[model samples]
Target: MAHSPSRVFAAVSPSAGDVYRDENQSVFNRGRKQTHLSAQSNVRVIEVTGCAEVSSPPDRACVSISVKNSKENVNDVTNSVTRRLEYILQTARQHDVKEENITVTKHLQRDEDLFHMQAEVLVVFLDFEKMQQARTVLIEKLDKSVCVGDPYYSHSAESLSLLRRRVCLEAVDNARLKASEACCILGQALGRPLLVREEESREWSSSQQDTSGSPLTLHPRTDPTLISASSRMFVTFELRPKDNNRRKF
Candidate 1:
């Protein structure tokens, strides 16, 4: 009653062909993986800079002094600015502002024909109660002498300052947010991020700078209000972009 082996069943089975197909598929997958790895760049990576603008009371103030004398008397203007500078020095000393704190930035003529002179002084600490009082007194006294017979007190004073750290910190935070946003956009394009970089330090605006340090290269979108600690401030930072494997190659 048992059937012969040949008559029992005769069905075709894929053996070497199927094995070869599977092996080829595996080889293709391996090749793809290797290609992807080879295409990846090994460029050094750094994080996008983060900046926060914070608000804090300014620690100091700066002011500029201008004096002009006409009637072809350049000497008059020079003498006038000098006298006023000396007076400012005296008043600063009286207010406990160190003598070194008062500096005259320029003592030159504005034009060869017209008698004009410019002077500048930095009020180290306008927040100081004494310095504030001194400022008012010095202004009044200078108005009488430096501004005398100059027609409507031509001399003008302005308040300038460095941005408070709190505000700067806020700016840093804002900058970080911007950097993150940029990264998000870049991530969608370049795949993903692998690194970021940021800087930590006090930066000064052109107006706030003194006779020290390299000048800061300002960013256009810099929050002027935030940068202005007392009156004005400026800062700088750099951004870095990277790629991450987030998309199908």
Candidate 2:
């Protein structure tokens, strides 16, 4: 007779709970690794704001001239105003004022028993001395119908553009200097700039007067020709370890 074969049992299988626990631990470790890698890729940076201001003298002037006339005949009034305007234009051209700089804003003629005509002229002068001379000539040569107003001071467009550029450059330089100093104190080296932004920019005018009266009175008492510009910059710079051999955390 054949002996009965010994019964063999299968190895004990892992429980469902044990398998789930092992999978959860593996996922948790994977998440931790991803977080560590993300942290390492991000760089450390410092942010700073800098400001600068610059001032310059005025470079342009504006003068206003008004012409008015009234006569029983409309033609007479028109002719008189036209002559005065022609005289003014001729004088301006003689003084080297460009045609583009002259503007006639208003010209009106009302019809009535007594006709009336009125006109306003605006002339911009780049040369202050010529502007003064024009004013004097208009007063001396022109009749009472023509009136001359005070000069308005301002900076030319090109001058203002240059000033703005200079102020912005200064502000950026100031920000870089501050960043370098801060890095030195923290025992770190400054790396490439991460970001550069202009936060604020403005242009204004300021006036100063000389209270002390001196024998020489060539200059005006209140000088309104000073133009000022200011700018602010925000910069972010990367921070690196002073020792190049060591890696940053």
Which candidate leads in TM-score? 2
Where in model 1 is the C-alpha error above 4 Å?
Answer: 1-56, 110-113, 144-249
lDDT of 1 by residue, 1-249 (tens): 011111000001111111101111321121222111122442222123334433332344444444434435777767777777777777767777665655557656556667666666654544446755765776676664343111111111232233444544454444344434443443422223342223334544432233232334333311221222221112121222334334421
Total clashing pairs in model 2: 0
RMSD of each: 20.8, 21.8
Instruction: Give the clash count for each candidate.
Output: 25, 0
TM-scores for all candidates: the values are 0.34, 0.60
* Model 2 spans with C-alpha error above 4 angstroms: 1-46, 56-59, 105-113, 154-164, 181-190, 200-205, 208-227, 239-249
